[model samples]
Target: MSQVVDDSRGGAGPFSRFEFLVAGRYLRARRKDAFISVIAALTLTGIAIGVATLIVVMSVMNGFRDELLSKILGLNGHFSAYPLEERLTDYKETVGAIEGVPGVRFAVPFVEGQALASGLTESTGVSARGIEFASVQKLDLLYKSAVMGSWDGWDEGNGVAIGSRLANRLGVSAGDIVTLVNPNGTLTPFGRTPQIRSYPVSVVFNLGMVEFDSFYLYMSMQAAQDYFKAYDDVLVEGAEPPDVLATDEEIDAAYQRVYRANAIEIFIDDPDDIATMRTRIQSQVTRPMTMTDWQQRNETFFSALQVERVVMFTILSMIILVAAFNIISSLVMLVKDKGRDIAVLRTMGATRGSIMRIFSMTGTAIGVAGTLIGLGLGLLIAANAETLRAFISNTLGVTLFPPEVFFLSTLPSKVNAGEVGLVVALSLSLSFLATLYPAWRAAQYEPVEALRYE
Candidate 1:
């Protein structure tokens, strides 16, 4: 005890060096309270597992959200502007105006409408989108990801392209003819009847999304506008029939078509600065236009993913919280078991603060050790997430990540520094708090009472 007092007085630091030495010894040495050691080990394991799971889960969530965003943004423009009028006739000038905005990258006129697609075997409803092949190819995603046929021949005015899922449903392929029924047919003295026309399938595209794959159809700029009567020059619903009772095909063919745009598809430099860019774009334009940004377009989807990420983080953090409780239990037993030593140290000149620091250091050491180990393991696992997923799935002969279910071929992970810091900070804070009661209880021991009991 004189040696401890000498060591305490010998050090000029915040606490005696002797305390840290003893704390480490206590942590490593065999204790009569074997169950206490087991509780301590369990506590350490819990903290490690909690931190690891939180990092891995959050990373995967971030990756999944990012992948979805990439696919959506790649297929759809970052921002789209709809005209106040039914169709934007002077879309060439409008595209120039939108492109003049600083952040605006790619601005192109697009025509969108609905048509009933009829194949030889079956029929289905489809969203028809018209794109400028040359300008849109500069966007390049559609051109590059085309599953069958080149991004050519669409400009020939009579060609059409459908998604793979749609192709499968309709039992049609490229070069085959698929009839599109336009409900807004020539309104004659008789009620408006359906106008159907057959067009050769130009290509098949796979957007890697089930909804898009099954329902979207694409065509050339002139072809789509002409088919849907998007332009005013195209025949109005009901003017006159060529014959008193014209067949549907004859009625459909009797139309003069011109280019009319329903919307301008725009790509911006920074998606995060959509509002500033939107304001800038609106300022540049003279017409009353409505702009929908990427976030606004898919608000519900991203919101749901964000909510799920937060909920998962909260639930997984409880693993560490439970470990904190175990830390409290282990420390309490240590304090009780070390009561005689605490009293002897007090008589030998160790202060109450010194006793508290020693026990607190013990608990912190465990927490820090567990946290570091978990952090390392978590990052490693997250980095090689796809690899790990494949290995487990192959070994177990189970589908760990189904492409149809998750919308991805393999698992994804994105380890964020801020999230990792948050987990580490939370773990350390919990560990520190768990040490308080036991450390204080140990520090409060009276030398006389403790010695008498001993």
Candidate 2:
């Protein structure tokens, strides 16, 4: 017994060489205590899995929100301005005025409305935007995301640009004809009828967002106005017709009216400073207009995302907590199994603190190793999240993240360093605290009683 205890009692300082050797020996449990070894391994595995899962889930949620926001803002601008009363017939002047304001990047006056679009094979409802060729050029996202065809002659030619998804559903491509049916038509004695017109598909774009790709399409401003009949100053319901011999000026006045814009989409230099920019824009513009920022428009969607992130974090944390309990149980069993060994060390001049330190070291080592492994694993999985999703979908023959359901074309992952750090700190802290109760229990064992039982 003396010889057995000699090697474990030589070191003097806290957590010394002798203490580590004893802890290591106990961790590699002998055949008699193999069950305790199994429990310790399970504890390590649980901690690692819990940490990895937490990191991956949180990163995915962050990426989802970030990706959605970027795509939405890219296509829709930072905010939009709509007229309070009457139509925006003076849209050109309004766009110029908004563009001149500080912090304003550019303002585009657009006419947007709902219409049923028909291709040869399929038909679907679309939110159609009427924008000029120059305005389309300024839209960097749409300009760059073109999958097929060119924007050349888009405005000059009476053609429209459709999303790739819409084109696919319609079984049409660039140069193919698509018919648009506007439900709100000119009032007649027989009541309003749907206005139907056809135009060539000038270009195809892929916005990478399901809603935009599948439900939104673009056409020339003049085409949209003519199709929707968005004109100001309509003549009376039964007004007298102008005479055929009327002067040229009278004929022009009776026939032509100003085209009206539904809203003006404004892009600004700094999206975060939207409130200040909004105030400045309103002050400079003369017309009575109402403004709404992107955040205001999608508040409910983003709020739900935030809430889900928090809830997922809280739920996943419990996994680590359960692993902590495993650490406590495994350490308690190790202490009981090594009671005689602890007593012999105590009798050979080893302090009670030394007993506590040895058991604590054993538990903490499992925690440290597990935490390091989990951190690496978590980062690796997060970095390749999209790739993995693709692989799984291909192998399984089912879409894991369908664009129509998820609203994103791909699975996204963005690992926040701060969040990873917090997960590691939490795991390590729980592991260390779990060791205290078992380590203290081992330290309290009396050598006389433990040896007597042995």
Candidate 3:
């Protein structure tokens, strides 16, 4: 009975410490088959490239998703409340009650209508939003983002705001007069007729999104009410008139007292809370109608992105699978070259299981080392993709991704821990699995046969 001197400095079990030693010896030993070393190096390089690409691609996807989400939510209110079919008579009271609801940040009565804006050179259809100018300023970040003019002018009658794209298309600047033509027009005793009015472009805003920048316009609630006659007359014949619509000026005065005087729109800070409030307000106040959040509005675009991501990931993973096969080939070649050494070890009392363990550990070492190197490289690239792009562009006079085509002006990347972890685990598992057959074949060799061949 030989005393097993604790070879491990920590007095750990013999098998535990010996496995590492065996793995190291096998890896360091020079072999005649230089092809095996080349194959192993290729395998490592393959894994590193695959991992790095996946990380960088996924990070870009995440950044795009985040950028679009912020732009959409930041431009549009989280939720809106409106009348179902009938115009709200007591909007102030309704908005007040809604303000008391949990998560209600701001509730402002808004009216939307389409009109053609004509400048000196061009005329384009635009979406006009009627809101409390001061309240809207607080809710919309665009007020602060104005490129020219002042948002304060929106408080005055006949004041309007236009996007930069629309301004350029119309060849107009701040203080320029633009004609607003409402196709639906106004109702009178004679008949419905188109209403054409002129308003000064009080402010010019630029939000960066092409669609919004090209079509969005803003006006004060008073100006909108006057232009659209949204508060004027009931369409019904001989219907019992409410105490409200007594006369034109009287009705306007009444609306001013009842609604505009005390009404203030509240915008909730949290997106989740805003969503909840929207749902609650719709259920309680508005009639059943299709409503969509900004995310859902662009579902197809987002869905396409997701599909692209999945396809890209699948394609990149094949590179790793190919590398795993390289690992298998290297191990097989190594086993063949060391046949005589394996036979001697067996004769010296090494079991087949121990032989298998040794080869498996060797394959695992290659995989783990490659994965760690890849992970570090991938993270570095993802963290500084923009800087890297800038450097490449400057040094080589070549752009990685040009800003003109891409919605974002620069390369965007956001590394997710979970995604990196998944890549690492996947590579390790594939490498371990690749070792099984080669290791098993080496272990199954008969000592006499292996010694005879050598």
* Top of the candidates by TM-score: 2
Candidate 1, pairs of clashing residues: 187-237, 187-238
Show where candidate 3 strays beyond 4 Å. 1-17, 28-33, 118-121, 137-140, 167-179, 186-200, 233-279, 282-308, 388-411
Where does candidate 1 have its weakest 10-residue lDDT segment?
232-241
TM-score of model number 1: 0.85
Model 1: residue 111 alpha-carbon error in angstroms: 1.3
Candidate numbers, best lDDT first, in rank order? 2, 1, 3
Q: Give candidate 3's TM-score.
A: 0.78
Residue-pair clashes per candidate:
2, 0, 7
In angstroms, how far off is 191's CA in candidate 2?
2.4
State the lDDT of candidate 2 residue by residue for 204-241, as single tens digits.
99988889889898999998888888786565455555
Q: Write the per-residue lDDT of candidate 1 for residues 1-454, one digit (tens) a residue.
A: 7787777656767767898887887798485878777888888888999999999999999998887887777778899899885468889899998888888887878888888999978999999888877665766666766787666656765787788888999999888999988898878899888878898888888776666778888888887777777766466466564686888767667765456788888988898998788889999999888988889888998999989988999999999999998898999999889889888889999888888989999998889888988899899999999999999999999999787778765587898999999999999999999999999999999999999956
RMSD of each: 4.4, 3.5, 5.4
Q: What C-alpha lDDT do the candidate models reach, one value each? A: 0.84, 0.89, 0.74
Against the hidden true structure, what lDDT does model 1 obtain? 0.84
Q: Candidate 2: lDDT over CA atoms?
A: 0.89
Question: Residue 258 of candidate 3: its Cα lDDT?
Answer: 20
Order of quality (TM-score): 2, 1, 3
